[model samples]
Target chain A: MKSDFYEFFCPVKVISGRQALSNLPHEMDQLNVKRALVVTDKGVAGAGLIRYVEDAFQGSACSIGHIFDETPPDSSNVVVNQVAELFKQKNCDCFVAVGGGSCIDTAKGANIVVTEQTDDLMKFRGAERLKKAMKPLLVVPTTAGTGSEVTLVAVISNVQAGVKMAFTSDRLYPNVAILDPKMTMTMPPKITAATGMDALTHAVEAYYCLQKNPISDSLAITAIKLAMGNLVKCVENGKDEDARLAMANSSLIAGIAFSNSMVGVVHALAHATGGVCHVPHGVANAILLPFGMENNLAKRAGEIGELAQYLCGREIPGDDRAKAEAAIQAVRDINKKLNQMSGLPNRLRDAGVTEDKLEAIAKVAVNDGALIYNPEEVTYEEALEILRRAF
Target chain B: MSQSSNKNDSRGLDSGGLAAAGASAASIYPKAKEPLGMNRLFSLSYPVKRGIARVALLALGAGFEYLSRHCDKLKEEISGWEEGRIFALSILSQGPSVTMKKENGAIRCVGEDLKNAEIVFYFKNIDSALMLFAGFIGAHTASAQHRTIVHGDIGIAMEALRAMNIVQSYLYPGLVLKKTFKRAPKMSFGEKILKAKLMLVLLPGIAAAARR
Candidate 1:
């Protein structure tokens, strides 16, 4: 059969340590750029991370354009266009994003306006649509997950259409991904857990993606191990730098895995929920994970059993049926610990999902592009069952 | 110690195997592997069964739950089967059987699983016998006797060659059997339906891989 896989990496220099924020200017100078545009939400802009970038660029060739700080939690196209207008007006040579997925995605969208000279997000919705590079984009995620800093995916929600338009292109990847745990130290435990679960879901889905190859499988396995070991610990103790750093690594690796292999029905369900009820993407995935894995388990018992062996860290002498269940139980154990530590809902009903909406949500999830790659066929009725279980 | 052929009467198995074994199997079908390839990977001795190729390729890693913890017998059954890790694995089979028509440099043979050769391995349960047939295909895939250009484009073919070399370096001696592609055995009604449904589940990956 023919293969349609394209692998590309964004060229970004990570200069991180205790004084990692101080390294940006020198790296920018080395890249030979004289001007920088600091893109972020007003909250982060007010926190003075932007000043660190400004102070570092004092004597170097780098200069800061006016900070575009009106970013929302879920940014809209208007905000992206507004930032792009500033990019052209200030003649900004590069972009420095000091926030989460939202800020970084805003910068990616704003870059399109600066170089591609168009604001149509629809034009670049599929693969390899943009053949050229955008201006140098730098992302420093304050949150430990959402590896937008290192990913080629730029997710933008078109609130008008109620669909999260996923704009994927190699050109959209940030040039530099600065992963400094200290940057994430200020996040609330809830925010940390939400993002961490998001990262964990990425790893889980990648491990099960039908297109997974040896390379992606290795990365997904490592990422999942990290998430299982550290996501909860970091959430419980916000000041623990080690756990924070581990989650950062987990998020980065999972991003790399899913970005290459794509995700499955968990993501398909999340996409539907996010589009319809405006649920946070990670929250939807967290609620559906065990259910989705169980449904896929009947047909894909072998792969699940292999994964179970890995999760158990040894071959447990038993029937394949028992082994597969053990692997899924491990996921539940992680979720249990995560909930105890982070305080997120264990079910959709707790997250405000109602039975009235289950059928519609399931129908939507069934049609999602991600469902086609699911380990098992999630017929329209099965999706509803998953929702009912979660609800 | 035994080259045994038990009736695969799924409806009756797991109970009184000795009494019910031969009644249905002997009259309805020929002996397995009359057209053998190798092992379950491919029994050239077995007649090319329906959709067997697709089931083997897609299910290369596809394992359903084991019915029992009795590993010794199962291992003995599959002991001769080639086992190794591969970079990327694919399976395809003929759709509903049809007359073969000569086309260009090759012949087009259509049937139950081959409806979509571009994504042949995506077919479902196909047949248990077919999985072994596909194993034979994978084993001989790089061998001279079964070597067919994996892809028409030079770059894709080169990639296949690279994968083949990697497989050779990392593979155990037993798994070399899958390289020789062969025809598979026929299937029961349940297996055929399962294979058809499973094919659609895998359809997305085909599109995704092609795009990549």
Candidate 2:
């Protein structure tokens, strides 16, 4: 057996496999919950996962206080406050967060208010800023992607400032994350494709962050290979359990990598797109991943080529330059396949980005946090040029 | 924070004639068109999953065509984060080498085109461009795994990273090398595995990694 490592950690108790949701009651009992709020989007509720969630807590000591089912795609600050208000009115003790990142993130924010009486998300913006622990939080992912259930970060869009209010706190980590393959098997192709790409982005970013240690490399590398092998298959046929399992595993693995090492330009760019364009986070990441990768080549030649060979599932020998070139080709080919196979967009411009505004984007991109971590040093003009080339 | 924008700053931009550094060319922004850009720098490692480049390129082309002003918004947010209090973090340090910039009255980040915006941009060729793009995207995915094994860790048995480090000795010796890492220390497979394992543990919500 290949030697394996396990440095990554999230406290969430995952009840996976066929009847994972059935374990919800048992898992909550272990956590010792009495009154838990079920947090989810309307769509998820419509899908009837709510009954299963209720059933999970049926025989348990826990009772449902209320289900704040008003979650949206880009959860705004308004959503957090509203949900928190519902939690208050219902007097819920703990939270059972279901749905994608949005619903789960909204639950996280609401828990902060219910536990601490703090609605000022702006005060807790940076990493490690939260002072007190929130009410017990349990996250159940309805989709294979959006590792939000495990991440310490919760992105809340503030409509007034037109900025994404990124709330990062160790306490933000869910007490439990229930990742069940059956839960994600029902995602439509579009959501599956976008979310799967998001997983790919996470693993890739973690492997290469400046803070990356030996530990992150192995997990990131493995996650990348998994995404490469499974994303397409899952997108092609949503019910394919193997593909679904692979994506779920990769998502879990990648979540560990980037949560520690951090991400660069693709995220920085995607964050911006999510704000102005109303594009989903994963979709934005998928669109910009290639452009960001291409820009990092010269500066990161050694890293790029080595990664390519691994992705190609081969042993690369001889000239580093040749190996690097092969890796680049591999990436291009993979992207071509994913794009052709899945209906995910391949360009920001095609997603309704205007040509005249390219210069401004370049200027803004130069300052995105991820850009700093990008292997190459990129300037505003250079960033603009990248956008231009993409256009 | 008061930097002299004089023509002769110590960073070497002032050493040569402005035209030689490609500053005189007509650029989108008059202040930015001709300033010498920074040199491209690389990270330590990456994932080279098949066909990522072509995929990213196609995605980039499509996104650029459709996304428009939202792309501009993305750029602006990055500027806000960068120009305000860019965090210059060191793996060994308690306080980041630099701090995350906050939007403060004292730190004026005017939404204006920069005369000398970047310290780096890699356009050596299209192939290089594609690799960089693919890697950047790939890194995003990898970061999630790294966090799990490192600082962000909350649970799990005997951190996976520690096990990975131990396994490195029993595993295959690395055979790939691009531009020999500039000044990186040679870590044993054990150490690398340990680090990778830890990274995966701490950062579980996100995947992949990238370095400046």
Candidate 3:
């Protein structure tokens, strides 16, 4: 279904290929920046992905000014302030985020702090609240799932308040996104599978969500086909650079799709599950996607059914409800395959969520901003029911 | 140069003729100095729409106050809000706004003042505001259409939206509710009576707020 009115914008310059990382310095030079701050986690740094980024800048005029590799799994306001201080102390002119969602979000948050010249990030926590243009940010996503590289939103946790602060604006998009297969080659099978499922969920939810439009719908279909074709191959053989690149492209495409169309109940529940039970976001998303689809089956059966061909790699011959159910079953089958191959959890219990936390998770889920774009209205009781079923 | 030819070249190009042409063009395509009929219509409708939105906001605020006292669901929804936390709904760019504050375990309409608001839900224009107020669209639809923006914590905004949904369920008729809500709310018989009572009080409440 098409929306009556919609707005879509993505200005990120994407450089993809085997040697996409080598274009980083030239990309920075195009932005008239000479110094860059590299934001990443210790995990990515330990995985030796930073070496590729360093190699990209070895002989270039643009240089890495500082490397802040202390980004936590959940980037926070304190961490953003710390990164901004480092960027200023080193006289950096740009940011090069080199990990997954957390690193990219940290760089985005830090960009807001540096550009707005504010140590307090809470004041700028909602949509289009930042009045200043952010510093140039170049992203090299080491994990393909989060797609923070192209998204115009960032979530930074406020440690003191124990609340996640979400900042959204067109300015949060990275100036460049480099998709190098070498960057993701080190991901283990389970992480790869989980992240791949996360990308799938993004594509599926974006296709059927309330904000869906023609452009996003096209991008979402492409993303779903790419993910369905390449995710398992990359998981089974981590060295398949072709499959890895395809999955990377899938994630990036899905990111663009969902960024415009927005996500729905799956992301709301996944965010809640991750916040309350400390579940990994990709795992939470993977576990909750089918249930979320089932929940929306009443309102969005035709749209969901349209996705059956892309998800199952074959046309499903049935009514909308039957095809929608088949599409959902395809998701469960993929989860089962991934679980057998890489032990990616397909149930909430296996993803470290206890039954006792379902109520708390539901409470948080109903308050998530993503719920506004959901096809079906998810009440507190409905959210609890979904959580209970997923568990 | 021939004086007669120069005079011919200048024909119909004198200052008076130029001014007449400009006026003719302005009548067809109005410039900054001349307001078009469409612009005049919009300008006239702007204040009327704003007035309607103002009253609707006041009525909504009043509904929140009333429902918080009587509606169990609304009371439960607002129980988690911090004391004195203020939120507002306004049209962008110097438009009329209504601020509501959480106090004494209930919501209070603080009139059109936006000061001390911890969060604000801004309609991008008066038309969007009127659409929502007139039950032509729901909050989620307006949000999904990007016709609205929030300036504070999104979580708190979502909570406020839930409360607003409850108020709208009572304020709007079942037919409008069915069209606007993602899923039309199912109200019990007592709740239907409460909705009727709310409708009875809403007019007087709007009149009272208009005086303020």
Clashes of each: 62, 176, 0
lDDT of candidate 1 over B84-187, digit per residue (tens) = 21122233233322211122322222222332222111222234334333343332222211122121112122222322322222221233332322212233
Candidate 2 — which residues are off by over 4 angstroms?
A1-9, B1-212
Q: Going through the candidates in order, what is chain B's TM-score?
A: 0.25, 0.21, 0.77
- TM-score of predicted chain A against the true chain A, for each candidate: 0.91, 0.91, 0.99
Residue-wise lDDT of candidate 2 within A269-338, one digit each (tens)?
A: 6765665566687777777766776766665555566677566778777676667677656655666676
Please give each candidate's TM-score.
0.64, 0.64, 0.92
TM-score attained by chain A of model 2: 0.91
Model 1 lDDT tens row, A68-111: 77888887777888888888889888888889888988898888
Which of the CAPRI classes, incorrect, acceptable, medium or high, describes model 3?
acceptable
Off by over 4 Å in 1: A1-16, A46-48, A159-163, A309-319, B1-212
Kept native contacts, as fractions per model, are 0.00, 0.02, 0.73
- Against the reference, the lDDT scores of all candidates come to 0.60, 0.58, 0.91
Cα misplacement distance, residue B13 of candidate 3 (Å): 41
Between candidates 2 and 3, the one scoring higher on DockQ is: 3
